[model samples]
Target: MTLTVRALRAGVPEDAEAFARTRRATIPYLVCTAEALAWEAAHAPAGQRLHRLLATGPDGTVAGCADTGLLAGSTAPGHGFLHTAVPPGQAGRGAGAALVAAGEAYLAGLGVRRVHSWVADEDGARRFAERLGYRRSRQARFLGLDLRHAPLPELPATLPAGVTLASVADFADDLRPLYEADVECAADEPGDVDVGATPYEVWLRLNWGRPDWDAGLSGVVLVDGRVAAYSVAQTDGVDRYWSGMTGTRRAFRGRGLATLAKLAALRRARAAGYVHAYTGNDATNAPMLAVNRRLGYRVVASEWRHLKAL
Candidate 1:
């Protein structure tokens, strides 16, 4: 039962795939792929101290994995994040503990004084976080929709006046407008962490450059030539698809623009052969939750944001 926890060797395809496998086993609601994992490791913003760790058993099998780092966009000092995943049967083997210890030590060395982690809202997960001195802060639900079974909304035959639906690829030449809209929407997203205005360069690298980001599947709503609402889509290039982010600018909130944008994105995803669609939202986001519920997205899992002061 001997185990070793060490930093993941970036650029090594095998290690990246193993790490992705562990994540998928532990958190299936979120999308994970070897290419996406490698991209995050290699393209993380310069200010964010990214550390990917792997827990390996004596047989060289990956028992668990962790992604930890400081929130580079946070204006508040000492804010850090650590998310660890250990498949069900591997929990008692000390893999979780080893990863947590290593992750905390790594962040602490980088001057992080407070760390945050998201633990699935289950008995064992809560107990583990409590034992590690983390306290619950907020909750978020993971929702899933079976594109092959559930009925989706039909696209309106006529477009609303001054409104047009388009794919993200249409803006390939210039994404500034989309970025501006995203920054505004992100600031209003419910969460314990305040990721203040995200810089265009950082957003471009981490989000726009993501391997799973399918521009054709991403939908945007423009009002009189201005971006009003948009949905970012991510896929595993298989059957799994994820709504990376769906939001509407404050000025267009109550017009159902967000819902329209998401519906368009989901339809595109289904047409593209993606069978499973998933998204996550904070429990306090009633509007978004209602929108997902109406779209037949059922709650599959929930996680509690846990905070620990170092």
Candidate 2:
């Protein structure tokens, strides 16, 4: 069976649908959708040099999917990244290899000096990437909480003095506070690369304006009317929920504000009938890992970021 690898065609709803279907099947812990796929393709920042790659069978079935581009928002340059997914049943047919090859070539052509890929923290997946010259650099765990059955920690009858838990929508009139906090927290996050200061407008378009953004379910902790900690949520408009990010400002750590924000978000999500809640955390982030542990989120799967210099 021959698998054709090429850039995914824009405006083709079927290709987007197939890519979403294949990605969701490959990584069940995260949420993906046809609309999100198309939106990402159309809205990528110019600096990102993003390209969507698709592998299709002779019958037009999507065998695998991958996207390659610069690590947009990264402070340092010459860093590229790719995300590849192949369905379980489609293994061993060279679909994954073909998709990754196309992505690397595209990035190399764009003058990228290095490429980062996230491979599942599994024996076979690691071996595959290692064989292709990618060395594992960092590990992140995907945690899932069964919202239908997990007992979320109780919210205090009254928030700690000078603090208020509010829906992210409450700050619609001004997002600069949230954006500033996000930038600070992102800089401190443990990762392979440092992110440049993303303009407020860029952040607004890429993060706050994403199709999956759910402001009502996202929580922000305000202290003295300042954005202190926040939990961002995304939904499939159905039962699955994703914690896009949960972070606390450096000035407001050790106060349990992160926990407070998460509880608010999870409770709101469960009440909205979302059954599963998912998030990812760096393996070395003990504070956040502890916060998630106390909240009943168990590690469901892990991914190792593998990097290769071109």
Q: Mark the regions of model 1 whose C-alpha exceeds 4 Å error after superposition.
A: none
Q: Each model's TM-score, in the order given?
A: 0.98, 0.98
Each model's lDDT comes to: 0.93, 0.91
lDDT by residue (251-296, candidate 2, tens digit) is: 9999999999999999999999999999999999999999999999
Clash total of candidate 2: 1
Residue range with the least summed lDDT across 10 consecutive positions in model 1: 193-202
**Candidate 2 residue 185 C-alpha distance from true site, Å:** 0.6
lDDT (Cα, tens digit) per residue for candidate 1, span 1-310: 8899989997899999999999999999889999998888888887888999999998898999999999888879999999999999898889999999999999999999999899999998999899989999999999999999889989789989999999899999989999999999999999787778877887887788888999999999999999999999999999999999999999988988888899999999999999999999999999999889878899999999999999
Clashes of 1: 0
- What TM-score, to 2 decimals, does candidate 2 have? 0.98
